[model samples]
Target: MKICCILCDRYFTPDKMQIKKLRKHPHRIILCPECHERIAERVRKRKKLQSLKRHPEG
Candidate 1:
């Protein structure tokens, strides 16, 4: 079954293109490649913030 991206609401056929998981649900929803990259970057930034919160270091 095809799923629509949570961000852009773009319809995508799973059989046609690669669908990358943006984040683990309950927040997770399907995302297109561009959205996927953007989300991934956001996740990375959040992770960095988490790490910084845990330990304040250089």
Candidate 2:
């Protein structure tokens, strides 16, 4: 089955393992690797900024 990435809307065919997982958990959605990495990077940057704002010692 071809699944579209929820973040980027990129359509792609998932691997066999992912297909099985999706079937087992239909509520779960698939995220493309690029979008996943981008999201993770953004979250990390945001967390770092927040931490700096919370503790502006140095």
Candidate 3:
């Protein structure tokens, strides 16, 4: 099945499991692998920055 990424608006073919999830939850946001990785990395970096801001070391 061809699924469109909500962020990039690119069409991609997801695996059976992903398709199942989309079918089960139609309201879920779909993202391509690249966009997903990029977003995840950004989240990780943001979390790290927040931790450093909370606890600074000499």
How high is each candidate's TM-score? 0.52, 0.69, 0.86
Candidate 3 segments whose C-alpha is farther than 4 A from its true place: none
How do the residues 5-40 of candidate 2 rate in per-residue lDDT, one tens digit apiece?
A: 998899988888889999999999889878878999
Residue-wise lDDT of candidate 1 within 1-58, one digit each (tens)? 5678778999767533343442223355557677888989999999999999999987
Q: In candidate 1, which residue ranges exceed 4 Å CA deviation?
A: 1-4, 11-29
What's each prediction's clash count?
A: 0, 0, 0
Please write out the lDDT profile of model 3 over residues 1-58, one tens digit for every residue. Answer: 8999988899999988889999999899889999999999999999999999999998
C-alpha lDDT score of every prediction, in listed order? 0.71, 0.90, 0.93
Poorly placed runs, candidate 2 (over 4 Å): 13-20
lDDT of 2 at 51: 95
Model 1 misses residue 40 by how many Å? Answer: 0.9
Q: By lDDT, who's the top model here?
A: 3
Count clashing residue pairs in model 3. Answer: 0
For lDDT, candidate 1 versus 2, the one ahead is: 2
Which should have the higher lDDT, number 1 or number 3?
Answer: 3
Sliding window of 10 residues with minimal summed lDDT for model 3 = 14-23
